[model samples]
Target: MDKQKAQIWIARVLVTAVFAINVQCAIQFIAWPESYTYAYQLSGASAEAVVRGYGICFLMWNATYPPVIAAPHRYRVLFIVVIAQQLIGLVGESLLLASLGQAAGLGTLAASITRFIIFDGAGAVLLVIAFALTMRAARSLKEPAE
Candidate 1:
C-alpha cells in the first residue's frame, strides 16, 4: 500500500483508540461517583459538586490528550507532557479531597490506580502503536522532485 494510505489507516486506528478510551472514561465516571467524591473532598468540594465538576474536567483532559500524542513527530514531547499531566492530576485529585474536608483511604488509592491502568496505560500503548505506524508511513513517502 502507498504511504499516504498507510498514514490514513494509522490515523483512523489512533482516532478509534481515542474514542474507545473516551467511552471507557465515561463508563468509569458513571460507575465511580464514590471514587470522585473521595478525591473531591480534598478540594473542599461537596460530593455532588465534585461529580459534576470532574465530569467536565475529565472530558476536557481526554479531549486534549490524544491529538498531541498521535502526531507523527514530537511524540517524545507529547509523552513527557502526558506523564506530567497525569502526575499533576493525581496530586490535584488528592488536594481536592483534602480541601473538601474529607478523609482519604486506601480504597480511593486503589481506585485511582485501577482507573489509570484501565484508561491511561492502555491509551499509552495504543498511542505508541499509532505513533510507530505513523512514523513508518512517513518514512515510506518518496521525496518530491526539487
Candidate 2:
C-alpha cells in the first residue's frame, strides 16, 4: 500500500477505536445505570439518573465520529472537533478529580473519575496523532509529484 493510504488507514483505526470505547461506555451507562452506580459506589435514584444523562451525552458526542470514520479525508473538520472534545473531557475530568482529592468516603468517586481522566487523556493523544497523520496525508496529495 502507498504511504497516503496507510496513513488514512491508521487514522481510521484510531478513530474507530475511540468510537467503539465511547459507544460501549454509553451502552453500559444507559442500559444498566444500576451497574454503573453500584460499581462506582454511588447510591440512590439521583445517581442512576446522572449516569443515564451522561450516557445520553456520550451518544450525542459520538454522533460526530461516524462521518469522519466513513470518509476522514472528506470530513476533516470533524477530526478537529473530536480532538477538541477529547481535550475538553480530559481537562474537565482532571479538575473534578482534583476537587475530589483524597477525602474520606470519596475514594470510589475519585477513582471512577480518574478512570475517565485516563481514558480521555489517552483518547486525546490518539486522536491528535490520527489528525496529524490524516492532515499529512491530505497535504501529500496536494504536493507536486517528483
Candidate 3:
C-alpha cells in the first residue's frame, strides 16, 4: 500500500522471476540426458560435475529469497545474501567451465566460457543491480521524509 511496500514487492517479484529462470536453465542443461554429451563437453564440464554444481547453485538461490514483502529492513540483509550467493555462483561456474575446458579441448573451453559469460554474467549483473536498488530503497524507507 505504501511506497516502501511497493518497492519491496517489486524487488521480490523481480528476484523470483530471475530465480525461476535459473531453475528453468538448470533443468534444461543439468537434467539433459547423458547421451547429449556435447552440451556438457561444450561447457568443458562433465555431466556429473555440472549436475552437482547446479544443485549447489539452486540451494543458494533459494536461500536468498526474502520471506516476506513488508519487511524493508529485512530485505537489506536479503540483498547482501543474494549478492554473496551471486559471487559464489560466478566463481563456481567459472571454475567448473574452466575445468571442463581443460578436460575437453580449447574449443569446448571457449564454448563454456562464452555460455557462462553471456548468460550468467548478464544475470549476475542484473541481480546485483536490483539488489543494490533494493538496498537503497530499504535505507531510504528508514529515513524521515523531509
Give the CA lDDT, 0 to 100, for residue 58 in model 1. Answer: 65
- What is the C-alpha local distance difference test score of each model? 0.56, 0.86, 0.61
For residues 1-146, could you state the per-residue lDDT of candidate 1 as single tens digits? 86666664775577466656665665566566665666433443456456655665667665655555355333435544554555565565556445545345555655565565456555556656665665555556542211
Better of 2 and 3 by TM-score: 2
- Whose TM-score is higher: candidate 1's or candidate 3's? 3
lDDT for model 3: 0.61
Report the lDDT tens digits of candidate 2 across residue range 34-143.
88996567789998998998999999999999888876766777778888888999999899888876789887788789899999989988888988888888888763
Candidates 2 and 3 compared by lDDT, better number:
2
Clashes in model 3: which pairs? 44-100, 44-101
Best by lDDT: 2
lDDT digits (tens) for residues 1-146 of candidate 3? 87766666676776666677766666654565343356445333565666556655665566555452234346566566666676776787777666665554457556755676566666677666666556667676765321
RMSD of each: 6.6, 3.3, 5.1
Clashes of 1: 13
lDDT at 19, model 1: 55
Q: What are the clashing pairs of model 2?
A: none
Query: Per-prediction count of colliding residue pairs?
Result: 13, 0, 2
TM-score of 3: 0.64
